[model samples]
Target: MGRLIYDGEHRPIVLDDRTLAHLKVVVTTKLRRHEGFTMSWRHPDNQPRGRSTIWLHPSIPLKFIFDAPEPPELNQRWIQDLMDSANSSGGIALVDEVIDGPQ
Candidate 1:
C-alpha cells in the first residue's frame, strides 16, 4: 500500500504512475500559487475504516510509490479547482494528497 497525504491527514490509495506524475504537476503548480488542497477517498480494502481525508500543505514534502496502479481517469474538476485556487492564492501552500501502493 502507498501513503496518501493531504489536508493534515495521511492515508493510502491504489494508483498508477502517469496519474501520479500528473498529480505532481498539478500539486506543484498549486504550491507555486500558495493554494492548499484537500483530498478525500476510500480507505484501502485491508483497512476496516471508511473514507479518508488529507490536506496537502506547502510545508510538507510528500512521497509516493512509483509502482502502484493509478486510476485510469483523473477527476478534471479537481484539477480545475486546484488551478483556480492556486491562481487566486499566488502560490500553493501544500501538495494535498499522496496515493500509496506501487504505481
Candidate 2:
C-alpha cells in the first residue's frame, strides 16, 4: 500500500500500478492542454488535515505528471473534461477518495 501525505501528515491508502497509471493520464493530458482546475480530497486515516485542495494547472509550481505511467485509455471524454477544466481559469476540480486496491 502507498501512503498519501498531506502537507506533512501521512495517511494509508491503496495505490495500485493501474490506478497510478490512470491518474497519470488524467493529470498529464490536462496539463498538456493548458487547462486549470482544483481538486479537494481527504485521505483515509488522515482525519487530522480534514480536506486538501490542489490547484491543477500548468502555471502551478508543482508537478504530479512525472510520477506516473501513461494509461492506454487516456482518450476518453472524461480525460478531455479534466484537461479542459485544468486549462480553464476555473482550473481542474477533483474530490479525494482514498484508493482501496492492491498493495
Candidate 3:
C-alpha cells in the first residue's frame, strides 16, 4: 500500500504501490507542463458511498509514499489508458490496475 499526500492534508489518500507509481508519472508529466486537471477514483475500502474527485494543480504539494522498498513492474497498456484519460476533457480517471499475466 501507498499514500498520496495532497495539499498537506491530515489524511492521505491510500492507493496500491503500482497504481501510485503510475499515477506519479502521469501527474508529474501534466504538472510539469503547468496543466491542472481533475482526478477521480473509487474508494478502495468502499467506504462512505461511491467515489471522489479532486482537482490537481502544479502549485499544490503532492507526495507519494510506498510501503515496498522496490517498485513493481509496470504495465504499458495500463499507462497508456491512464494517459488517454488524463488527456481527455474530463481529465484523469483512475481505474483499477490491470495485471498482465502470462498467456
Candidate 4:
C-alpha cells in the first residue's frame, strides 16, 4: 500500500501503488499548470465506510509514497479518465482502474 500525505497532515490517505502512481501523474500535471482541483475517493475495505475529498492546490504540499521501489505500469486510458474528471465540476473521483480489453 502507498500513502498520500497532504499538507503535513497526520492522517495519510492510503491507496494502492498503482492508483497512487496514476494520480501522481495527473495531479502534478494539473498543479504544474497552476490548476487546483478536488479529488474524491470511496474508502477502501480496510477503512470505515465513507468517502473523502481533498482540495489540491499548487501552493499546498503533497507527498506520494509507494511501498515498492519500482513504479507500476501506468494505464493511459485510466489517466485520461482521471484527467477528464479533474476538469469536470465534480473534480477527480478515484475509481477502480479499467482494463483495456479482455482479461
Top candidate on lDDT is 4
lDDT against true structure, model 3: 0.89
CA lDDT, candidate 3, residue 58: 91
Q: Which stretches of candidate 4 lie over 4 Å from their true place?
A: none
Cα deviation of 23, candidate 3, in Å: 0.8
Off by over 4 Å in 1: 1-14, 68-103
Each candidate: RMSD:
9.0, 7.6, 1.6, 1.4
Assess the local accuracy of residue 57 in candidate 1 as a C-alpha lDDT between 0 and 100.
72
Best by TM-score: 4
- Mark the 10 consecutive residues where model 4 has the least summed lDDT: 94-103
TM-score for each predicted model, relative to the true structure? 0.49, 0.46, 0.89, 0.94
Worst 10 residues of 3 by lDDT: 43-52
lDDT of 4 by residue, 1-103 (tens): 9999999999999998999999999999999999999999998888899999999999999999999999988899999999999999999998678897776
The regions of model 2 sitting more than 4 angstroms off are: 1-16, 47-49, 61-103
lDDT (CA) per prediction? 0.55, 0.49, 0.89, 0.94
Which pairs of residues clash in candidate 3, taking residues 3 or more apart in a chain or in different chains? none
Model 2: per-residue lDDT, tens digit, 1-103?
A: 3233323333323344444444557766666788665654454473565755665567655422223454344335545555555556655454223433587
lDDT of 3 by residue, 6-100 (tens): 99998899988989999988999899999999999887665786888889999899999999999887788888888899999988899766777
